[model samples]
Every structure is written in C-alpha cells, then in structure tokens.
Target: MALYQQVTGLEPHPKSDGDFTGLNREDGLVIGFQRVDGYPAPRWPDHRSPTASHLLQGQRGPGGSRGRLLELGAGKPDHQPHELARARVLTDPAGHPFCIVRG
Candidate 1:
C-alpha cells in the first residue's frame, strides 16, 4: 500500500478492510482496492474482470474544482438530482478498478 501511495500520490485512509483499502486525494478523488487471492489480475477494458466490478463516483465542484464529497457505498450519502452519471472506468498499475464521474 505504501508503494501504491508513492506511485499514485493518494493517501491511504484509516477506513479500510482486509479485503479492500481506500485511497484518497486532497482534491476529492477517492479510490478503492480489493484483494483477489489466487486469481490473476484483471485486464484493462475487460468488463468480465473482477476489477471492473468497482465504481467510483464524483461530483462537480464550485469554480470547476473537484470536491471531496462522495455519495455511494458504505455510509455515504445518496446522489443528488444534479449529479451527472458521466462515469469512466480505468485500471491502475495493479489492475485495480477506479473511475471518474463528472456532474
């Protein structure tokens, strides 16, 4: 996880799990990781992969700056009506799935 933080410039949050870890940036970007034991890493652009199951949602901020408000999973809030569902999924070096959603 330290190596991941170093490479991605994301900070590891205290809220994490044995099967997963949460990463974040000061600019409101949040990412999650899941451990796939005994299974090969997922391939990019492959929806069949386990990594593709993960989704990250974000909202637009004031002055075009992104905010740290999240509205999905765990104890997060519900999505607002103005929040656009423009989602784009991408994979990290470890084949972990992440996404960017603009509203």
Candidate 2:
C-alpha cells in the first residue's frame, strides 16, 4: 500500500496517466505540468481547480484575467487553528506542495 492508496482508498497505477479529478468529482480539478520556470509544481494530491472553473463558473470581462487559484485551507482572522498550534502555517491537503506560474 502506497500514499495514494492510503489516502484515496484506491490502488492507482504507477506511471499511468491519471486524472485525479475523478477521485473527487465535484471538486473539478486537473493535474499537469505547466511549462513555467522558477517555481516548484506540486505532486500527488495537490489540488488543482480546472480552468473551466474560472471560464465557466467565474466572471471574466474583456480585460479581465483568466483562471482563479485558491488554497482551500484558509482561516479568517477571528478563527484560529483548532488542530495545530502554529496558527498560521498553511498545510497542503494530503501534505502535497504546489506552485503558481505566470505567463
């Protein structure tokens, strides 16, 4: 049993091209290597919202930008971490890392 197995409860194939979006459908995500430099792209379990989430679900005007990126784990100032004591250390879902790139 590997990490994906432990987390997703499925035996995902190694080296097989997979769409994690199917693992959690309503989340609307896609995983890929973006051709950008200087930033570290996330590996397994890193959340990626599909481009359609912004193009179809969000509002974009003639001069507006494309896509929306959000970290699911965020806290309001009034709310503090009830689980971890650090209070501000944003941990990735499933402990995966992520990076943003600009073109």
Candidate 3:
C-alpha cells in the first residue's frame, strides 16, 4: 500500500473482507482493487510508453539486456525500442493488462 501511494500519489485503497488475493510474479506484484461501480482495476507502473523505456535503460548498468522491441498497447500501435524487457508483465484480476518494468 505504501508503494502504491508513493507511486500513484493516491490514498490507500480500501479492501474487502471477501476472498480476494494478490499475485506475485517474477516481473512484479499485481494488486487488485474493487471499485464501487462493481469493477476491478489493477495498478502498475507506466512502462507502456516508449519514452519510459529509454529512461529505464539509462538507469540500468552497462552490459544489460540490450535490443529494440515493440510494446503492444491496450489497443494502440506498438511502441518500439522500449528497453523494458527486464520488467515483468502483470495482468489484473479480470485479465486486464499491466506492467512493472524498472531499470
């Protein structure tokens, strides 16, 4: 929750006592949030943008994974050279798309 607040600058999301849970993947953590409108949304880093990839690559030390790749957006055109291969792709509880790639 602290991480989410820091990253998104949002308040701590309230949780339900229902049988809800979270997933820990090799890429990153997937957090589930249920909305009052009866929908589930997930929070992840904004690694989908091409510019974000470049910044990440720069932060990573030398001799890391290097190569140009395409990042397929939700339905937009694929962004190229997103140096976020080391990042993990995490899906929401409802199978929504999210990613947590960092250098």
lDDT of 1 by residue, 12-46 (tens): 87788899897898877876766668877776555
Cand. 2 TM to true fold:
0.21
- Clash count of each predicted structure: 0, 0, 1
lDDT by residue (tens digit), candidate 2, 1-103: 1322232333333334332222222344322222234435333233462222111111132211212222233112222234343122221333333222222
**Any idea what lDDT model 1 has?**
0.52
TM for every model, in the order presented, reads 0.38, 0.21, 0.24
Clash pairs (backbone) in predicted model 3? 27-88
lDDT of each: 0.52, 0.27, 0.33
Worst 10 residues of 2 by lDDT: 50-59
> Cα RMSD (Å) between model 3 and the true structure?
11.6
